[model samples]
Target: MKLVNIHTLIFILLFIIIGLNTAQAQVWSLQQCIDTAQVHNKNLQMNRNNISIGEQKEKEAKANLIPKITVNADYKYFSNLPYQLMPLSTFNPTAPVGQYKEAQFGVPHNINANLQLSMSLYNPQVYGAIQTTKIASELTELQYLKTEEQIFFEISNLYYNAQILHNQLAFIDSNLINAERLLKNMQLLNEQLLAKGTDVSKVKLQIAQLTNQKESISSKYEQVLNALKFAMGVSIEQKTQIDPNIQFKRANEYTSSTILDIRIIKTQNRLLSSELSTLNKSRFFPSLNIIGIYGTTGFGYDKQPNDFLKFFPIGFAGIQLSYPLFNGTVTQRKINQKQFELQNSELQFGLLTEQNNMQVENAKLQRMVAKKAVETTTEQIELAKTIYEQTVLQQKQGTASLTDVLLADNALREAQQTYLSAVIDYLKADLELKKLTGNISTTK
Candidate 1:
């Protein structure tokens, strides 16, 4: 029986050890998370497909200039041949003038077949459409990059939140350890009649509160981790941990470059400009094309002794030119509308540029303020810890009241919270600044 119990205990211990190791193995770096999301993200896949669609459209527009070939065939049979008018002077040279007779003109059965070919020599619309689609392709690529930047920003924020919660949980555990030690010290003093039972009760209450806080923070940490997993395009049930270590690096002053947003707007402006250009070209330029046809016509008549079949070859080619003489001013109206659109796009570009500039400056200032807070909070936490420790020693030596120890403990907890809050603020501001400056990337 003793041997069986030992074996069971050993198995339980080994199981727990293996579980911990497995969990640790699932830890993902920020780059790993981003790489997986880029590969599996649905939005990114759609944008990539959009780029392909744009390319095909560009090709389709160019195809409009290629020669188009077609074959046509027809067959017809008449029940009776109709009569035609003929002059009465056909038989005699000096017959009565203005006299006429009726005559039939064609065979009863006829067949015709033709092959037609047409190619555009110069078409303003087709050429303009090709240019438009090329611009649209560039626009689609920019949109994909914009989505990528957004995803990176989201994942970074979620990861930062999880790290903050993790550190908060660590702080709770640290407080719990201190509270448990205080409780033991108070209990010893109570046994010797040097401390009251109420003091011991107070320490126990603090411990209980710290334990509750730890539970709450742990739950929040799990929630944040789940959100991070979702942002990374992974299964919600998948077990993963972020890099627990959070570092705050003070960045030097810098101005933002041309971010994705600016480039996208500029691309949009170019597209609008191209639309206007196409409309103007269509209104002024005449379309020119070459058309050709080659075919044969067959006539067949079935009769007792006059049965006959005959086919004649036919071929023709021509150059065609078409200019819009008038169409109720429709093209002119469209041209006016397109010009208005171009003007609006120009205004929008200006607005976007100014807005981004404003945001960049504000983000820079916020990060600076948050960095100062982090420094201040760091020193405050050290001072609070020292105060709490000295008060505990004083209480053990009978120089400090129980109320003083509790107050010091409360101050220490407050300092810890303040420090964590400051660090989070700094991180969030720094992330925002990086986004504005277009510096956020896998390496940074």
Candidate 2:
């Protein structure tokens, strides 16, 4: 008896420990999940890399204005050739027409080395390059921001879908519990000769149906959980519960005046406009450059004592002017192409503005409709719950049939689920409004 009691105590303690551990697991909130996803997502990180590359391009644009310097060196050996020398009477006059004195003849070996520096004094190409790179950086930045927005959109939908599945599962669990209770009650009543065998079979069938419903909902819930984990970049081997506190805050709290406008894209378009203006200016302005070179070369015989003549440091400084004189009408065609592109961009921008307006209007209408749905569903749930409680109590008093009680229970569960769905829809619409208006905090 003592050993059996000790074993029972140990078993109870183990059960308690398991329950405590299960209860101690943490539940992640929606914002926390989104933050985790943004931190760990591979594609978002790649977009960030693209942004860094754009910054490097911006650095390159700045570097274009800096001067460039280079060094050059060469060596040569001549065994026998027409050596060069100063204007001296040549002893080899009879040997060749232009041959000089053997002593005055240039050296048979030569080496030349020099350093040269050049800076762009005035070059339209440089200006155009700078402007183009700046625009490219801005465009890349916009693309990164757009990528972030898209991730947020996808994550939000996945998170909400998981929540919806969770609620549906809760409904199924509740229904399953009710069905099991009804089956047990019918079984007991039949044993006491107060219920028919047919009643027991009917309750068993209800339990079976509820079991199938639970299984179906469980499958759907697993699918939704997997999708949510995927969006959050969580591993399949990991297990985590979601917090149900998404209902703690209303969408009104996240809404503000700043959350109602989409002006960033417009700002980018203006930058593009400035870029196009710079490109147009580039077409007419010719480039100006200053070129200067200093070097030394020699070919003489024992003239300067270094196996070569004196390193006559040659230097030339000059200004070069160049312009696109003509190119099969390409320049004019390019200008026309740019004009057409600008027109198309303007039209697209206008269309985007109109679309954004429609989105905002639609979102607002959806939120309003969803709000009404929540209100209506809330009232319906209250009425259904009242009816269910009354019907169940009447059944206990033998004043209502089992079917009436079951119908009332199902109706209440459906109304509750409908309310939850409406609430989720409202929240999603509110998020859409914020996203469309560029109001969501995207710093992460």
Candidate 3:
């Protein structure tokens, strides 16, 4: 019985060890996470498919200007009927006794195989369509680029979030260790009668609170890890750790106000203008295309050897001319519609540029202010630490109370937490500024 129990314990221990190893194997770097998300994100894939669809539309528009051909087969049967070109006594002589027939014909089949060509000889709409489709294709390509930008933005933010959580967890662990040490020191003081029962109880209570805090933080860390896995397109069963040491480097690169602030919107505005130009040109000229046709036809009405044995090949060539004179003001309405769209696009572009400028300004200001806050908070943490140590020594000499020491310790902890959080905010904001400047991916 003792051997069985030992074996069972050993099995459980080995299982836990193996599980930890398996979890560690799934850790992903930031770049790997971004690449994985790009591959698996459904929205990005949908945008990619739109690009292909645009290309297909361009191809279809070009194909419309090409000639088309077809083949046809038809069969017909006729019953008794009055004959116009036959003699009056040409009734069927082989008819039954009481039956009379004016004319009779067997089943006849007509076959027509024609390679017909119909090209746009004079159609402004098709001509405009090809150019518009090309522009549309370009627009789709831009949309793809826009999607990539958004994905990178999301990945950057999420990756930073995971790092923040890891840092928080580390802070919590450090606090836990400090609290446990304090508890042991309080136990020694109590045995020596240097501290009262209330002091010991206070230290124990602090330790318990810290332990609870650690548990709470561990739970939150697990939640953040799950979110990170989702962002990385990994399974929930995977566990991973992020490198908190990866810091954003400040650069004297070109300011966002100078460039990269409005280029994206500018690209869209240009594409829209291109569309308007195409629409305006559609009203003036007609498209031109050459059409060719070659085929054979058979009437099959006659069983003559000449008709049945010969393939009736016929060919015809012609040019089609079409001019849109007027339609209940359709062309005028279309032109007005396009003009309105162009106006709206211009307005939207202006608004976007303004927003981008505002974002650049705000990011710059926040970055500067956050940098100062980090510096101030670092000093505050150090001062708080010193004050807490002095308060503890004074309490040991009976000159300070438990409340003063507890207050001082709490202040130090708060200061430390604030300083750590400030650092994270500053770094994350810096990265965001870089993203707004369109340099998120430049840092390898």
Candidate 4:
């Protein structure tokens, strides 16, 4: 019974260890990586923060149209009372008209308190600002979309690179296995005096070279994996594996109108044109405001001579109107400046639209070429493998030289590398086409 209990504990421990490892091993698909990056990427988060700031600015602009109320208080101390001069003849009718009297009045302390309210009734600038802020908020949202598209492209590119590295490593591993087998056979032949020592040495050198290439590819694979993780906003300490299922196909065509960069510039141009219109309208319009105030004036005096404290209430309200008759043509100059800015934005929009069209065309051509290369390399790799196998058999039969086998091996490796490069190119070109069409934001 004791032995059985100990065995059961060991089994439970082993099961828990296996369970932990399985839980830690996670495979992330392309969609999963993009989604995670959208939420966690530092640059994307900063863009989101800009959106929040834009929203708050819009709220502030709207608040400017509402009434503003404030309460204020002030105190003053007078070491000597204020004096006033009066006509003395008013008190005594018989006195001369030039006679006057001087008197000291009021207390030595004073206080004032007030509550004021003011609101704009008709201010063109304020109204224009409200509209401008609304547009600015929209621009910020578009910027976030742009950032998302950029991050998606980066992640896709890195992920494609990692996949290419993985394929290369696999190729190297396969070649290493073949080279080791050939080296072992050569060693056997050399011992039996059937193969030259130089042939055995050459085979051994080939195996060593393949081993070095494998190690180098392994190191590169790890680097690419780390870069993929960084782009996905995943922790470097975590182990991650990408889903190896990738399909290559033709990308859909796109026009300049679908490009995000072009769209963004067009939106900005619209905003600038609106600003110019607002500035022109503001020059001819007037502003009106309503103001009101309610307050109390307090007076206090020391008891040594005259002990008295009094408070008097006051209130008033009125309307004010202001017009910019002329300010040395400042408004006109500002309007001119705004018009220039609008023109500049329009030019930028045009330039960007043309550039994007060029990019779309270029990417399409690249994708076509890569697709063809992939097909060609796939056939070449098969042919190379068959040639290598035949050459190895002929060498063993003493019909082919050792150099023939080496040449076949080199050709196979070259074909494999070409295929990997073609695949990477196709994936990247497809991603670029999607980006140009603004499909990256919606697609996985």
Q: Best candidate, lDDT-wise?
A: 1
- lDDT against the true structure, per candidate, is 0.87, 0.74, 0.70, 0.85
- Pairs in steric clash, model 3: none
Task: Kindly report which residue stretches of model 1 are placed more than 4 angstroms away from their true locations once superposed.
Answer: 1-24, 73-113, 190-198, 296-313, 442-444
For candidate 1, write residues 93-113 as lDDT tens digits. 788989988888788899999
- Please, what is the TM-score per model? 0.84, 0.79, 0.78, 0.92
What lDDT tens digits, residue by residue, belong to model 4 across residues 407-438? 99999999999998998999898788778766
lDDT of 2 by residue, 1-444 (tens): 999999999999999999878865767777887788788877788888998998898788778678777888887766765645533334434464554443334457777877676777777767776776777777777777677777777877777777777777777777777777778877887898887898888777877887787788778867776777777777865676776545623446333333222344555566666666665666777777777778886545664545435567777777778777666877677767767777777777777778877887898889888988988998998899799888867876789888897789779888988888898899789778778766755422
Q: What would the per-residue lDDT of candidate 3 be over residues 1-444, giving only the tens digit for each residue?
A: 999999999999999999988878755677877788788877778988999999999999888777665554444433333354444435655545654444544325545677767767656566667877887787777777667766776777677777766776676677667667666767787899877888879878887887787778678778877876776567888667766764744434544533333554555566566666655665555556666667776655444664442347878887765555556776677778777877887787788777767776787787777777788887998899789888878876878877888898788778877876777677667776776776666642
The numbered model that scores best in TM-score is 4
Query: Model 4 clash pairs?
Result: none
* Model with the higher TM-score, candidate 1 or 3: 1
Worst 10 residues of 1 by lDDT: 435-444
Query: Whole-model lDDT, candidate 4?
Result: 0.85
Residues forming the 10-long window of minimal summed lDDT in candidate 2: 253-262
Query: What's the residue-level lDDT of 274 in candidate 2?
Result: 64
lDDT of 2 at 256: 34
Better of 2 and 4 by lDDT: 4
Candidate 4's C-alpha runs over 4 A off are 1-5, 80-106, 250-257, 326-330
RMSD values for the candidates in order, in angstroms, are 4.8, 6.2, 7.6, 2.7
